[model samples]
Target: TLENIHELALGIELAGVRFLWALRKPAGTGNDEELLPAGFEERTRLRGLVCTGWVPQVTALAHGATGAFLTHCGWGSTIESFAFGLPLVMLPFIIDTPMIARAMAKRGIGVEVARDESDGSFDRDGVAVAVRRVMVEDEGKVFATNAKKLKDLVVDEGRQEQYIHELEDHLRRNKDV
Candidate 1:
């Protein structure tokens, strides 16, 4: 987990964009400084912030200045980002997240950071490329447009109620199966 954090720090630093990283300190680590790569704090002082405590994720996502979400593609976070019409840079690690990431990519809503085939490890370059693609590059515009479309769908109460009703009907029909 520490290794992942270190790599994330390196990657974000290399990305060289203004960032607010909500880093939960690893268990058994006493100080916040030890959780990051050496000189990372100093180097990124002007353009980056690593918060070690509770971060109000919804508030962050709602901020007008926020451009893209770098996330692990958990269902809740994914939904929240979509609700805000923020394009994503996904780095999924486990469970259904990778599948969700792939689906999102196919839908033009995000870019998944590339990982090593053997070890599934990602590096700074991959992180930078993914972030840039979703944040600054021309391709980002498409992702942004798609994200806005998704936001409309996500925030539509009528569509949500319809989905719920459909789910309930399907469950009722399949109750014995």
Candidate 2:
């Protein structure tokens, strides 16, 4: 896990884009500094902010300057990112997250960081490439457009109510089953 964190840090640094990283320190780690590569903070000080405490995720996502979300593709996080019209750079670790990541990638709203099938390990290059694809490359525009469409659907009260009603109807029809 520490190695993964280190690789993420290195990859984000290599991406060379402004970033806001909300890093929850590994359990039993004494300080945040202990979690990062040497001189990473100083090297990225001008373009990055690494917060080691609890962050207001929604607030960050809603900020106008925020470009894309680097997430683990949990349902909640995925929905939140979509609600804000933010493209995703996904690094799914477990459970249904990998499936969610794949679905989002298929929908063109995100890019999944590649990992080793044998060890499930990802490197700095993968991280940098995924970030750059969603943040710097021209392909990012397509992701942004798709994300905005998803956001519109997510924020539409009428559509939401329709979905709820549909779900209720389905449940009623299946109540006997």
Candidate 3:
């Protein structure tokens, strides 16, 4: 998720949106923050930075002010975005990330940066381009609209309870059989 904040910040800034990249300086991990390339900070009109943990990060993302999620495409984060009805700016860092991006794209959940396999790098330019595409492009709005619809489904208590009860009954019947 730390990488997510970093990756998203670039895109958010490029899309002319206010942005932040909150990170956790892991205990004794000795990994320095891989800073944006020279001049990027100035060019992108960089905003604030924070060193925070997961709960607070999720809290931040769920806040009413949060319009979208620029995330790493972890299943947990993906679900969280869905729960909050926040459209995603997915940047999958793992092998599964591309898959998640593809699926979410289909469902109008988010967008991912294109990878350059030759260098194994997502340079600032690429990140900026992807961010704009997802945040400002028409596809981004479609993703957000779908995300809101999905969130409504999740928040419908009556539907949820019905589904849960049905699941429980089905389980009980199977156990008896």
Identify the leading candidate in terms of lDDT.
2
Worst 10 residues of 1 by lDDT: 25-34
Query: Best to worst by TM-score, what's the order?
Result: 2, 1, 3
- For every candidate structure, what is the RMSD over all alpha carbons to the true structure, in angstroms? 1.7, 1.4, 3.8
**2 against 3, candidate with superior TM-score:** 2
Which residue pairs in model 2 clash with each other? none
Worst 10 residues of 2 by lDDT: 25-34
Model 3 has a clash total of 0
* Candidate models: Cα lDDT each: 0.93, 0.95, 0.70
Identify the runs in model 2 with alpha carbons over 4 angstroms from their true place.
28-33
Compared with the true structure, the alpha-carbon lDDT of candidate 2 equals 0.95
What TM-score would every model get versus the actual structure?
0.93, 0.95, 0.73
lDDT of candidate 1 at residue 168, scale 0 to 100: 100
Question: Where does candidate 1 clash, by residue pair?
Answer: none
> What lDDT does model 3 reach?
0.70
